[model samples]
Structures are given as C-alpha cells and as structure tokens.
Target: MSTTTTVVDIAPVAEVQKLSLRAADPSESKPEGKAPEQEYRYAHLLPHFSEDRYPPLEPYEHVDPGHRALQHPNPRSFLDTAERVIEITPQLGTEVRGINLAELDSDGRDQLALEVARRGLMVFRDQGDFINRGPDFYLQWGRHYGRLHIHPTSGHPRGYPELHLVYRDGKQSFNFEVDDSITTTVWHSDVSYELQPPGLTTFFLLTAPPTGGDTLFTSQVSALKKLSPQFVAFLKTLKAVHSGVEQAEFSRNGRRGGTVRRDPVEHVHPVVRRHPVTGDEALYVNRQFTRRIVGLKREESEAILRLLYDHIDKSADNQARVRWEPNTIVLWDNRVTAHSANVDFRHLPDARHGARITPQAERPIPALEGLDLSA
Candidate 1:
C-alpha cells in the first residue's frame, strides 16, 4: 500500500525529555521536610510515581462508597470485581451484577469500558444511585472517556447548550407516541451520518414498563467476520452514504413541537472502521442511515447495499438483548455495534424515560491502514 504523509505531534516530547532528565540526576533533591533519599528511592521505580519528588496524589476519598452501596445494595451477589466475559444469549438479555458505575475509579472505569466495548453491550440493573442525577450523571460518565458530542443544531439540556435533548417527556425529546416510527426502527448504529461519528453512548433508563420493553445490540465485528472474503474486499473498497440531515429531519418530525428543520445532510464512511483505543477493526455500516455505496452506479449501489443490510439484519446470533429494570443503565460502543429497541410494551401505561450521552470521535479510520487489524 502507498503511504501518506505521517504527521507526528511532538508537543509532548519536550515535557517527556524534561521528566527524563530530572529523573536521571541522582542529586536532584526533594522539597523541604520531605522523605529521605533512601526512603524515596523506591518510589522513583514506580510506574507513575517518582521517588525523588512527590506531588500529592489526588484524593480518591471524593469517591464516596455510599454511591456504590446505593447502586448495589447487596455487593456480594451483585458486585464482582474480577474481569468477566459472558455471552448474552436470546434467553438471557439482562446481566444482573453489583458492578457500580458510579464507584469506578480511573482504572476500574477503563476496565469496565473495555469490557462494554468487547461485549457490545452491558446492563447495570436497578441503579438507584444514578436516577437522581439522571442525565447529568450519564453526561459525566460519557465525558470521562471523551468529549460530549454537541449536535450541529441543538444543545444538551443541561451541559452543552448546543446539544438537543432526545427525550420525549422533556424540553427536546423523541416522541414515542402511537404514530412514531423513528424510535421503533431495527438494528442501526447511532449517528453514522457524520464523517467521524460518536465513539460510545450511555443510556440511563429511569423508568420502564411493567413488562416486555427491551433493547438489543448486535456485534458488528462478528457480523463482518462471517462475510465471504470477496464480499469483505468489496465492502472495504466501498463507502456508504450516511446523512445527519435525514436523522435531524426525522427527529424534528418525530418529536412533538420540535422546531428543528430537515436539511440535506450526508457523509460517506468506510464499511469497516478501526477503533482508536482497542485498535480493533469492526464492521461499521448500518441499514438505518446507510443509503448507497459510492463509486458504483445507482442500480449496482442499491443491489450491493440491499445484500449487506440483509446480512447485518439476519445475524441474530451475534445479538444481545437487555430487559430494562427501573433506574438501570446501559452503555455500548457505537463504533462497533448496531442496536434496536423492542417496542412490545409501547402500549403500557408506564413511561420509559432515559438520557443518552454520545462522545464525539476524533477521526475516522481509513480502510487500508498498516496498523494491525486485530488488536
């Protein structure tokens, strides 16, 4: 493959050099009244902590244990710290655990995030601790990993003024009325219409119907791996039309009293994308926003797109379903999975309310990179 200009950012190199020099100097003394050289020598060998000088570590005390306790009343059965990988079959949509999202430290959060990314989707049942903060809490957790995505037109209700609320019962909500079809759609990645779409989305379900409403997620990586090599090669060469304008327009019409206008929004992205953190390549196209393939005639594009969409739709074994419980939360990687809501309980009297925080992607991974495809 022909290589493009490799632009390397060197801003951090200077700081790294300074730290190295400081560490090399054996005579570099500690601040007044600090520990002796012998005592601090061992600290320098630590990964992040240097023995020579000590900057007060940030207190983890701000992380309240009560937060974890509230989320997991009985930690024994509900909470397990050891890493776990479980497949959620059709029969088991929900995974009940004591993993408290609110109590996760930086390392814990990273571990959980990776697990969620790997598993496609995860559920935290009966998260009463999160309900009070509601959407605000979700925003915090989402932003912890990356920046919150601000909609091109609308603003978030609380955080970013430009991010429009997608909730139907609130200031800017998606209408779940009898006539709405947008929210009831099947298997799709969120906001694929953008050039660089969202990385992850966190949803907090504050309320749920008495029975039958659930969310399903399908693994895109597994789906792509099953495709024939010929089809995979063809897909790699093609780009799909995804439109933000179409979704915005749909949202405008779907929400009651929403003033947002529909525009001719579209973007083209590769059928497969490489994740930044995990370095794993995943199937990236979806049926919802993906309209046609570029570099092909209309008929050819339609035929190819139809087949690909059908493949993604029919791969039921790769999917995981989650039955909602009150104050429950779910998070999934938008880059690697497609999801749908089961609206069987739409007629139920109880309202399902929740907030979703989508983090913006830094860049789109091109198809023919030299980096390892399996990371």
Candidate 2:
C-alpha cells in the first residue's frame, strides 16, 4: 500500500502578502481549562494650575463690535445654568459642564464663544450624544461664529470641505505610558500658512484610544504676557512673514501631497498680535510656519525666531494637555494659542479620529499704542 507520487511547487517568500511576524499562531492559545491573565494598570493625566501663569482671569463678557450691550441683556445668566466651569490649567483650557454643546441655542452659543475667546479653549467631555451627529452637526454648531474654513491642501472628507479631519491611526501598537493622539507632532498653529489664519478651530473626538493621543496646547496669551515688557515692546515693532507654501504642499494627513501652490499666500504681521474683539495680545510667530522676521538680517531673524519657537514649545508652565475621550469637543482659538499633538503611543491599536472646523479667519493686527524697538 504505497502512496501515489505527487509534485508540489513552493511559492517564493516575497509573495507572502505582509503578515506580522510577531502575531501568535492559531494554536497559541491557552489550554482548554486555563487562561492567561491580563495585569491591570492605570494612569491619570495631571493638570497644573499655576497662579503665576494663569493669575486670575475674569469671565469673558461679549461686547458687540459696536460696544453695545444690546445683544447681551442677561450675560450673567450664562454662568448661572447647570454648567460648571473648571479651570484645568491656568494657561488656557477650561472644562465646562452643565451646558450641552449640542443643544445650545444662538444665545447659549454666543455666551459659550465668549468664554472660549477668553479661555483660549473650552473642553466638553462626556458628550456621548454628539458622537453620531457627524460633521453636519459640528458645521451647524460652529456656524454660530462664522463659516467653517475649507483647507485647500488638507482635502476635506468628501463633500464636507468645511470640516478638516484630524483622523489619526498611528502605529496600532500599545504601551503602558502614552498614546499617539495626532500625528503632526510639532508646535504649530492649525494653519498659520493661510493668508487668514483660523480664528476659532474646534474638534470633536468621536473615537479615542485607551491610553495615548493626548494633545497639548500653549497659550500665546501667556507666551506674550510672560515676556518682559521690554521684549514685548521690541516685538511690537517687528513683522514676521508666515508662508503658506510649505503647508499648502502637505495633505490633510500632514504628508507632502495634493495641489502644491506655486506661490503660497504670505502674510506679514506683527509678532505681538492683538485679538480683534477682546484686544488681547498673542505672540503670533509659530515654530512651523513663521519663516522670517522682515527687516532683519538672516542671522538675526533665525535667532529671534528660534528664541520665539523655543519659548512657545517650552511654555509648559503656561500650557495644558488634554487626554481625549469619546465625544469630547475641544474648541481652541487658533488666533491666541498654538497646539502640538503628542505621538508618544508607539504602536498601539489605538485609533483617534475627529472632525476639526476652523471658523472664519482674522487678519492678525498688532495694537500700536506705543511701539518702540529700542527701549
């Protein structure tokens, strides 16, 4: 009883179609009666409140462009609601409760925007209802301010050009320490490259990882405030050129792709930019886009820019980190703060996807009360 002769052709190893070598084999599970146990570990993000950095901020009250209080009859009624405002960090961000962002009316939105303008950003956690509402909800929600911005390079998701996507699926691996929130791991404004930088940029975290992807935001208000009056006086006399060329070359995913603008729009604005409504000053130069300081030598420009960049990145004393959870909305004023997405999550199966909308744009202008370069 001999077996029939057979011939088999083996395929080349190159054609195995990319499988993870570390993946366990089909038979690698525990025996029928035994199971492996997962060790429990937990961590919490600490929010720092520095008196020197935050001092004490007054609640923002909306004053109409005409400086009339007609639009705000019962302004104090906003804080009177069930909403509780918690100052997570003195630098900029605040966590607000008792008010449902998804259910706010025109008046409620206006009051909310006031706090957002004053605080730099307002974070709404535990917003499960808004999870499936999609971009349409956010578009209408943010429309209370102005039209949502459409990025020319970062291709908007399908028909929603107004909604810039901050969807990240970085290294689907894991760690006990940190998670990779957003891939653009740099200290930069949302779109300083634009002729009109975003005034208000809001994001809703629909999906969040278990441990990583914490975003960090620095207060330009604090950045400017901490500087010596002499430095601010010097900065007021200077103009920095923010180039859109490099940014327009990259896709929404932060890679170099899409329609490369031949000559990206360039805007020269003072380093100390004043908020149009509140008249608050923010150090406008960012690490990524503000290329040069006009009227200065190359060396001088580099030195000054490097110093500013370092200051923005190192303003941890005046910065806050947000550990995102599902249905969390972070509304940050791009006009007043710079943000950096931390990618500390190595390769966790963690996925962080969100919708970001930039509401309107503002031409950065410096308040010229008394500008003297030489003190």
Which candidate should be chosen as best, given TM-score against the real structure?
2
Error of 1 at 51 (Å): 55
Encode model 2's per-residue lDDT on 1-375: one tens digit a residue: 001100111111111222111212345666778654321110000011111111211223223221221258764355576557789887788887665667766676666666677888788865655545555776887666765556554424444556665433343211111224333457778767555667766776444556777888989999888889988888888888887665644422234223332335676777888887677888888877889988899999999999888888776788998887555778888888888777654465445545677776555667665433221
C-alpha lDDT values of all predictions: 0.54, 0.61
Write down the TM-score of every candidate. 0.68, 0.74
State the weakest 10-residue window (summed lDDT) of model 2: 40-49
RMSD in angstroms, all models? 20.0, 14.1
Poorly placed runs, candidate 1 (over 4 Å): 1-85, 90-96, 134-136, 152-173, 176-183, 251-256, 261-264, 370-375
